[model samples]
Target: MSIVFEPVRGRPNSGGRLTVGTLYYGDARYPIRIEDRALAHLKIVILTKLRRNESFALSWEKKPADGSGRGTVWIHPALSFHFEFSGSKEPEINMAWLEKMSESANRTLGLRIDDEPREGEADPAAARAGV
Candidate 1:
């Protein structure tokens, strides 16, 4: 399976921009159904790292709890990256989450997804052990 995510602006707006972009992996493409807030946070982290020519790992939980574990990808500036936005207005920004994710990316472990950044810890080993 391939990993994909949609980039969207943050909430609290009247615009109905459903999807910002289709993140493609290999030959497969999947819609990024994550909430707008989380997606916005992710986009900021990704762009900041890539803009500096830094490569890091991005990990996220997989749906359906199929026992396969979480998904991770190494993001680099050289990759064929693209983000399509449906609206001209920028979404609301979550600075705290972006800072946290940025700090994680700068670490050796890279960035791990916390759908709700304040809700739980991001431990891949713990997640795998649970399954």
Candidate 2:
């Protein structure tokens, strides 16, 4: 049997900034809407743990529009993940966000999408380089 997940509301096709992408898991039957920029960074951290053969639970709080609940999934190396981006260009990454997320993924509760750290904590090298 397959489970289907629909977005809380239809996304507009205004091009560029209006598009919302999907992260498909569980044999592509389960779909989660995520912005390209955030999803890109998430993919990096998730893949790292999976590459090490680690299995963990990933939980996310649902938005108010999405019924205001929570969802959790057990991610294992055996499962597949397909990230479908709506835009052609890749978004810039924040190293500090990656570091914070990596730390969370290592914890007992597993990965939770955390907010990006404030300035000065973003990237030490990039900051020094005046980027």
Candidate 3:
């Protein structure tokens, strides 16, 4: 089954900007459980493209046992969007991963979501760039 992540416009606070969102699967909607840092990174990537009137595909691998290979969605600026957060605090952003994901979104093949970033992982474009 495909899931939809809706971005919520959060209120500003003394600490920093907060972004909260939700993940919708099937008939159920759940408050996004992603780390605030990662969620923020995704927000920037998505909004940047949308603001530029760019449309791109976002793909994520499916659970192996689910028998589905991957899930993808076409994101566009004209579409209605929202981001909602359940908490008041924000997590530290991971600049490396954000950069990697942003690069992937710019590639001809489109963005492909992978496991959360880890130390020493090769640059995401290395494989696609044939370097």
The candidate scoring highest on TM-score is 2
Best by lDDT: 2
Model 1: per-residue Cα lDDT over 1-131, one tens digit each: 43333322234345554543345433335543444455566778888887888899877765553334577677888776555455555666655557667778888878865534343445444455794
The Cα error of candidate 2 at residue 117, in Å, is 2.5
- Per-residue lDDT for 9-122 in model 3, tens only? 322345564433454322333232333454566778888998999988766654555454656667777666555455566655555577777889998778754445665666
Global lDDT of model 2 = 0.69
Clashes of 3: 8
List residue ranges in candidate 1 displaced over 4 A.
1-21, 25-33, 65-68, 85-89, 117-131
Query: Predictions ranked by TM-score, top down?
Result: 2, 3, 1
Local distance difference test values of all predictions, in order: 0.59, 0.69, 0.58
- TM-scores for all predictions: 0.61, 0.75, 0.61
Kindly list the per-residue Cα lDDT of model 2 for residues 16-119, writing each as its tens digit.
34455677877755588776666677889989999999988877877766677778788899988888887677766778777767878888898877655555
In candidate 2, stretches whose alpha carbon ends up further than 4 angstroms from where it belongs are 1-19, 122-131
Q: Candidate 3, overall lDDT?
A: 0.58
- By lDDT, highest first, what's the ranking? 2, 1, 3
Clashing pairs in 2: none
What overall lDDT, based on C-alpha atoms, would model 1 receive against the true structure?
A: 0.59
Please give the range of 10 consecutive residues that has the lowest summed lDDT in model 1.
Answer: 1-10
